[model samples]
Target: MALKAPSFLADAMLGSVARKLRIFGFDTLYIAHAHDDEILKMGIDQGRAILTADKELFKRVVKAGARGVLVSGAGDLEDLVHILSKSGVTSVDLGGIGSRCSVCNGLLEEKNQEQLKNGVPGKVAEQHREFYQCMDCGKVYWEGGHLRRIRALAESVDAKLGRAVAT
Candidate 1:
């Protein structure tokens, strides 16, 4: 099924994976020190797929009728992609390419010219007209050289995963 929010609740052991999922534009919640019950409850309550390394926990959540996936035998990006593939995740939302915030999991909104004058540096304000600001954290995003690097990295990851790079 297509997820309503396309979000994941990753357990403490999968903190890095959760962060990378955010980088891939997926809304992921990472709680480094939560109990199993708390993790399962919030994940289910929020309609997020539970991603965990503990096989027993995975079984319990799955048996409870919660959508989940057991992550084991790997701890790298490639492994994460593979594990998530079972849940229908792909390269459609590459980092910074999609609307989700890279830092705060907030929806990014386009900032007007007037709003751009405040927090944005003078040089950046003059150089780029199109800018996006995070609704939750108030962090700004711009189309710059760094964005190109993100694009390149996304492309590389997609290519490595043998999937088409998102346009």
Candidate 2:
């Protein structure tokens, strides 16, 4: 298997962005109440690229000699994607969708029906044979309509970005 790209450390306000990154199978570390210094420290310590919505934090990361991506206003993904792409963050290494846990940022481990029976409802278990459990949070996930919708959205975003870049 190809090695995944470097992980990310998202600042407090960027939690939603972090979740979206996980949905794309990226290892994104999110902290809800992190100060700029703490976030930068963690990013450096963990060898993670810092993601922030604050210009000061972005500048700090750059000054401190750390890799970072400054997401534009309020975590809009198109802008985030654009900024990340500019910093060499591409979908080429993003791997399969939903491969990481949106909740705890853990890798999703494939689990059979029996392993997830307790967490899943009886009807769901009977209907679905495949399941994935978050290795960190134990949240159970199944391939249903949401997965398809998210995937479609991702594809659309990619296509739009491609077109925008080509112009």
**lDDT top scorer:** 2
Write out the backbone clash pairs for model 2: none
TM-score for each candidate, following the candidate numbering: 0.74, 0.86
Give the Cα-based TM-score of candidate 2 against the true structure. Answer: 0.86
Q: Across residues 1-167, which tens digit of lDDT does each residue of candidate 2 receive?
A: 24446689988877777877788777789999967889899999999999888899999999999988888764345755664565554443324687999999988989998777599998888888889999888999998888776677567556656665666
Clashing pairs in 1: none
- Per-residue lDDT of model 1, residues 12-102, tens digit only: 8887677566656778888889888998899889998988889999988988898888888475555566655666655445634647676
- Stretches of candidate 1 off by over 4 Å are 1-5, 72-76, 94-96, 160-167
- What is the lDDT for 158 in model 2? 66
Task: List clash counts for every candidate, in order.
Answer: 0, 0
- lDDT at residue 157 of model 1 (Cα atoms): 61
